[model samples]
Target chain A: METVDLKSAGFGSNKVIEWGIRTFGKIVTRLLLQADVVALTIPKYVELLRREYGAQNVLLAPHGSFEDNAVMPSFEQGAGPIKIMTFGKFGTYKRVETLIEAFAQLQAPEHKRPALELVIAGTDSPNAAGYLAQMAQRYAHVPNVRYTGYVSESDVPVIFGESSVVVFPYTSTTGSSGVLHQAGDYGKAAVLPNIGDFAEVIREEGYTGEFFQPNDVDSMAQAIARVIDNPANRKAIGMQNYRAARGLPMEEVVDWYMLHFETLLDEYANRKGKIGLAKA
Target chain B: MQIIEEITPEKLTLRLSGRFDAHETPQVRQKFTEHAPKNALIDLSGVTFLDSAALSTLVQAMKNCRERGGELTLANMPQPVRIIFELTRLDKAFNIVNAPDAP
Candidate 1:
């Protein structure tokens, strides 16, 4: 099985580095295309690979969610600081400054902001080191803003459990989002940009979310406000997400893959036997 | 990290200790590949910390084992190390158990 989550050939401000990345990406893409069957998490990637790279055997393997754990707090029990959390590797495409700014904007009297805490979970992208630190320094005065550095797997439930709403502060997409799947698994309403893979996944996967234009702080603030302001709306979307996550559990996806592999193996054996018979 | 291997007719268990980070992943990968047990149990009780590189190594090893009609089960995980799996939701992908006394 091959994943088509290609690293961007064009990011950062360095021309030489960008060219090198582009070169490496081409090599990796060539190698990936050589696979008997290439599995892509995003449907768009499958189309792109087939159309752009002339890859014939691309398969759309949707990102799978785990079975529902009791770790998530019940929707009714979602009280406290009204935590608006975003979990991902920060900087580059998945920057948090926009979310932080939007969270700050959501605090305005005009928006009738509720008691909220902006929780930034996970560390900086490997290419963008010290990014979270810079963001922290930049928005140091923003009250109730908490930065959780490199959250471990176990802490995920607790962190997600505490959140009132999950936000995706991504400026762009990099394949199907595990964080989005995690948010759905944990039964949290999402607020995200209505663009690229985010739009595609929401449409394909039956995830309901409050969407705002990318990089628009006001739009983001208002979108987030819509959910946090109404418990009923939040619960409805969260419930839908929970159902969607249950619909395609990772175990079922793996079983599907095993079936496909079995077919491939059978065909391979038949081909080998035919070759042997011809030689005889 | 130290990997103590115990191979029985039923399965192969590897008891690991210390930080399972990027630095130690190469050796871990090599050891797992060398053993290539069909039914494998990795006892992570003694593991203090885990990094992304180590996680990737285990994932690749799990896939390789699964391809060979075997499975990888994580056993006796410490809370800290377990959290890493939970955060990535990898705990679901892997068969995890707390059966400490299993022979």
Candidate 2:
């Protein structure tokens, strides 16, 4: 199956889209089911199916994590060259500058810098090209900082798998984090600034991660050090995170959706049968 | 659209009420220009909601006042209105007063 990573809302965009699609899908499915038609989508979208469309007229198919490979072997020990990944339209809100500064501070003279590779992977936001350009110039002298303009979904798993930690330094009040969830599913630790729904996600999942004061460079730097310095702790936290993320897989999600579709389909079939029987 | 104009030696106080959205911002901007005072004080205590457009207008007005060798100050702003300003980081740009006595 082909996957498209719209990469719209950092960590929360996928779920938000799922919610909107499911809600709208349900209404459409219900109408179609009454007309004896069937509909389908992936499992993560089931809640939208059940909540919006009746449980009867939907077919669900599950998929693996965006980075999951059925053929390739998964890593057992989480400790590796620390890969630090971040992506967003560069803005004051994303706090990419904070992450860059934090990473810079973490690099030490003697300690090999924990094999630190920082990737800021996305295009610039409106009127933010100048700001991002300034950042690029500021950090150009720093080693191991890669600024990828834009990346596709197929590249995500490769990108995510390489990383030991994902960082989200948001400054906004209302928003969700999609990067956080994807990182969690991939069993990578995350470092998020305390903002919006980020704290709730990290706290609820009990992931191996740290929350720091937003816009505070020192606090962010400390959080980065905590992850870079402690690999065993990072792996343990990530492993626990993987377990928490298991229930959110595509198959279970699909099955739930199928149940909803069948119910709606049966209702339509029964109604049509009743009409035929009455005519006879 | 409600405008309560107050004149003082230091500033001109215009207390606004009701929705301060895109539609209202034009009226506010026009009124500000028409009055064209040297110093202006805007009280947003009664405003229920203020969108980004409204905030932009306020910023423009402040800039205009500044150019004229005067200042535009906000006074008696309601909690929700204040929150919007804070959210957009415009609290730093505007001198927001919670109470009449406080600047």
Candidate 3:
């Protein structure tokens, strides 16, 4: 959850329920002990949770990208052609149907529209094969749409390299997305909804974030168009994203976690020392 | 980068799209020097960024054009590009104007 979501919950029924639950938990007293430190993927939620729980033992550890930094493949180039792709599992939360519907409705010349390739990449499973079949049938008439049912870990970088833009049409999510970091690693601009930590990731990645209304096809199309139309902005934003990703490489994140671990251990040791002295 | 060129009896106007940086400055410089136009107007509204190298090339082109008793002016500068000029005080040195008069 974003800071606003946690902060905006009113002190009415929701707060009443929360208070009631806290009272019940305190009365029951299953456990009063807390973890030595709390780790959360999204920084905003970490702060809100810390304040709510009145505990400062919280660590903000944003997710890291893949350790392998092999040079990515070249993006679609030259004038008159553009390619937009999305990578992830086929799930209800992804809202990928919105992207397809918008692509079908986009008003452009056949020659030009064909320039826009929509690649929905994911490994098929029992959960989504039926939904994927429906989408394929629905857009059977549309051109330049490629659906790679399953992509291996080795091929993820290659797929990212071939595209100019990555669309994250998520309708709902609990935490930050690794996809944002993955796309950033390739210097690709992400068309994401302005919700939760999506916006924060975009901001941290500088010029790579393009936002649309959640679950709106027209809004997603417009957002994608904004990046496609301006070749220079698109390239510049991609480079900016690359620079941002470089700052938080895998090794750096590991080092940060190690440091946080040390802080926790020291705090624990000091507490033990005080208790021992008190007992004497 | 895309360069939109126009050759009228009076002068030459080149509208540059994308980034005007070191990577593109040479091409831009060549466009200005290949044929010396009496009055040069480079439309920059479409440009998203302009680095110091680009700034230097523009200054050089302006100097050359003036040597021939003409001026090299930039018009329709995007805000981000315009801020570079203002911050460097190049806005005073160069013939920078609104977009309407640029094209």
Put down candidate 1 lDDT per residue, A1-280, tens digits, no spaces.
1222233312635768556766788788889889777777666677677777887666665566865344444876356778999998887778787888888887766766667899999998887899899999999988899998989988988898899899998777766788888888888899989877788887666688999998898899889988998889999889877766755556556664664576567668899999999999
Which window of ten consecutive residues has the lowest lDDT sum in model 1 chain A?
A1-10
* Residue A75 of model 2, lDDT score: 35
Off by over 4 Å in 3: A1-33, A72-81, A110-114, A124-129, A205-207, B1-103
Model 2 misplaced stretches (Cα beyond 4 Å): A1-64, A67-81, A108-115, A126-131, A173-176, A203-208, A261-280, B1-103
Candidate 2 C-alpha lDDT tens digits along B1-103: 7877766566667788998765577678787778786777788888998754465567667767877888778888788877655433356456666666443
The digit string of per-residue lDDT tens for model 2 on A1-280 reads: 0122223223335678766665665566566667432433223234344455455333332222443332332434346656678877776466577788877777767656646778888877773556667788977877788887778978877787777777877775332355665776777767778763555444433344777898788898888777767877677656655644442445434433443454456667899999999999
The recovered share of true contacts, given per candidate in order, is: 0.00, 0.00, 0.00
Task: Tell me how far the alpha carbon of residue A253 in candidate 3 is from the true structure, in angstroms, after superposition.
Answer: 0.8
Q: What CAPRI class is candidate 3?
A: incorrect
* Error of model 2, residue A257, in angstroms: 2.9
Q: When superposed on Cα atoms, how far off is each prediction in RMSD? A: 15.5, 22.5, 16.8
**Tens digit of per-residue lDDT, candidate 3, span A38-134:** 5665556555655666655555554555644647534445343466888876645664678987776654574264366788888543434576777
Query: How many clashes show up per model?
Result: 5, 21, 0
Better candidate by lDDT, 1 or 2: 1
Ranking by lDDT: 1, 3, 2
Q: Candidate 1, clashing residue pairs?
A: A153-B83, A153-B84, A153-B86, A153-B87, A154-B83
